[model samples]
Target: MNKHQTIEILLGLLGTLLIVFALGLYILNEPSRLEQAQGDILQAQLNDAMTLYAESCAVCHGLNGEGIGATPPLDSGALRTMPFDDLYKTIARGRFDTAMPAWSKDDGGPLSDYQIEELVALIQSGDWNETGDRVVNLGLAPLIPFTTDPDPVLVEAVGSLPDGATLQTAIGIYAAQCVACHGTDGLGTGIAPALNDPAVREKPADELTRTITYGNAGTLMAGWSNVLSPDDISAMVALIQRWDEVPTGVIPAPDVSIPTTAESIALGAELYSANCARCHGPEGQGRPIAPPINVKSFLSSTTDQALQQIITLGVPGTAMPAWGDRMTDAEIQAIVGFIRQWEATAPEVAQPLGQASGGGGPPWLRNAANATATANAATQPTATPTSASPSVAPSVAPSVAPSVAPYQPGAEAGTGQGGGPPWAQEQAQTSGSAPLDWRVLALAAAGLSVAFTLIASGISSLKKYR
Candidate 1:
């Protein structure tokens, strides 16, 4: 009894020890799985934050966070390496002297602290190699305002400008220098504020001129004082002042001429069809993917100077590719000229008209005209009835009577009023007689004669007629 009891007790104790060991192993592995789940959740949140940052911040920070002009770069930047708390504060507060716009509520940007935290985490976690080089923290001083009064010599030079300089002339100057960042229409791009908006328009004339001449502090807007004389600055100011007054309508001075020689427009047509039809459409009516090159819209929306700039420097961070490298300046100008010519000749919305007979027919018409002609032919009366058999004709002749004559070559074809070749006369005699409109029949005969004459003339010119 003692041995049996002892054996049973020992087995129970061994089973309990094994169960405890298994529980201990499970406990040891649980934390790792939990940590892995947390890491996955964090990564997902980071991805979402990165997407928002790209849409909102990447424009200024650059696609890979390689900042341009005034906006500081973010890839492994000092700001990124800073303590999380300090980084959070700076993002919330925003730097004052630059275009590094505050993105948090306390600093006037729209992001919440939680969102900002997520963004910061994502930026910090990004590999510098994959993203870009680390931004240097030079701790450069903020741009200070001018302390000295305007130079008397400069003031006098600006004051000497004639009061009658036109805005168009001023825009030409701006296009050469300022349009890259400020945009062709004065609507700001990536790191720049819009000059066409009310905020810029409301600024005093002198302030505007000073900003243009001296440039804004801590921004990419470089001082143009070196490039442009004070007088030129004054002209620019006058132009900006008149920006509101400029008429929003088409000006007709630059009349583009289409070459009368078919070769030139024909080459242009082929080029336009191949390269531009995808976005601008076969007729230059813009699709949703691209802006309209329609004449009225083009004239109203872009100045001549602006068009030149856009062709020269493509917009950044957009699908608009630069053609300057591929196209010669003369080629660009020619293309512009062609576009202008198209606008002039295009039918107005109020007065719709088809392309002129010589101007190459409307694209849709050219594409479908042959198919439409074929369809019409199916219903038209042919020389012989398709269903009639020569053997059975006599049996059915009385019921489906058709007047026919023996075939003869040029033997006074029926109603021989229309001038046609000998082959047409033979055809008329063999086929059933049907009434044909004299005018239509005559037109067809004349057209065929002209075509054959041209063919014969071509052969003669080629010395193959003998």
Candidate 2:
């Protein structure tokens, strides 16, 4: 038999075993390689679809599907969560109320059902990282750029509030027409004016009413007169005025209170600085391109209902974009609270001269001043003014005679000839009067609080019933 034969056989067996082990290792790794290949294919398909989305949908949906005004965002949106059938139906049917045109012939647009399906898939299934447990970038989907060109007719139509409309109704109207440019917080963004500024708050009711009704010419502001009735204008003005009166240091709603939540107002402050400070300004002073938000006038004027509606629905025309699909209702509410909190804590600014006058200045100047005041009130001040004056006095006094001076015209041994303009004297008298009738404000606040409570209860009940 022989030792030589035994050794040869053993060597042969070891060689065979080594070859088998190498083959096993290759087999074990093959599935991962295949999976990688499959992922690459999916990513390529997604890239193609995203490219298509950019080319075909970006104009309306936004580059990131954040959606321009009127168009819905597709990124991790309701459409993404909706049943494919419903999604298909919406795309096919098109929303008549908005500019979202039907994509399928069945409804009216140019795309086919298959294309719609593909788009939906690309939006929903596109993973940010292929190798790392397929996590979807929910934030990425709704990152549509905000748009400003809302149809003037649409703005007017939506801004119109029927007589006796509730604050909620008024808010809904603003949401459809103002939130985009103004942001859900009423803090100005891009090319919009803040609705909460002291200057705006101080504007005469009539002037404010006129601005809302007629809108600023040659600007993104669209006249809502065609859509809103005079009564509606009055209601809106009333609302704005109310916001203007909110106390300078009021707190945010309880749910959004920084002390009680996982996310602090401090965090919100950081977020605002990063995401909102540029357009809104560090102190929320309305920039030339934006508006202020921290003034008492703005907070007092806007109701919570209105704030929520604006956050959810957004303004249709103009640069304001809808965030309904981008942020959760809770998140939006938190943001609203954050802005309100800012209004409460932010330093106050004086109203502008023209705004204090009630009516005699250029419309644009008035609008700008008002918008600035409103926007500034909501962004916590990076640098608050050392002294808060009620008004920003004009640099140059008017050339009116001493007799016409608003404060003191002439003084001859207290003959009263030294007193300022009659109107100025009257204003002084009023200013010297007792502080605001807190009892009356309290009563109004109580009444509004009750009304809101009831409404909330009813809504809760309805949800339960459903």
Q: Top model by lDDT, which number?
A: 2
Tens digits of lDDT, candidate 2, 1-466: 4664455455555555554554565577568766766765555556545544533454456545555655666765665577878776766655554445456645435566766766666766854232111111111112112432333343344344443234334555555555544433343332345565555667899898878775664334545666677876776776565553322211111111211132323334544555554555554444445556555655545554345445445444534445444444333444555676756654456244243334435667546756656555544342132111112111101110111111111321112343532323544553342433543454455555556555655665587679
**How many pairs collide in each candidate, listed in order?**
0, 47
Worst 10 residues of 2 by lDDT: 392-401
Please write out the lDDT profile of model 1 over residues 1-466, one tens digit for every residue.
4654455455555444544554555566568756766765665555556545543555456545665454567875676678988777766656554444466755445677888888778677754332221111000101111111222343343333554344555655655455444443443332244455555567799898888766654344555666677877887787666544432211111212212223223434554555565655556654434433543534433443344335434443555555444443323333444555665555322111123234554666443443333332343233112221222222321211111121122442121344543323444453432322443454455555556555544554476435
What lDDT would candidate 1 get against the real structure?
Answer: 0.46
* Candidate 2 stretches greater than 4 Å from native: 1-4, 84-98, 102-118, 127-466
Q: After superposition, how far is residue 443 of candidate 2 from its true place, in Å?
A: 87
Q: What TM-score quantifies how close candidate 1 is to the native fold?
A: 0.35
Every model's TM-score: 0.35, 0.27
Model 1 spans with C-alpha error above 4 angstroms:
1-18, 127-183, 187-466
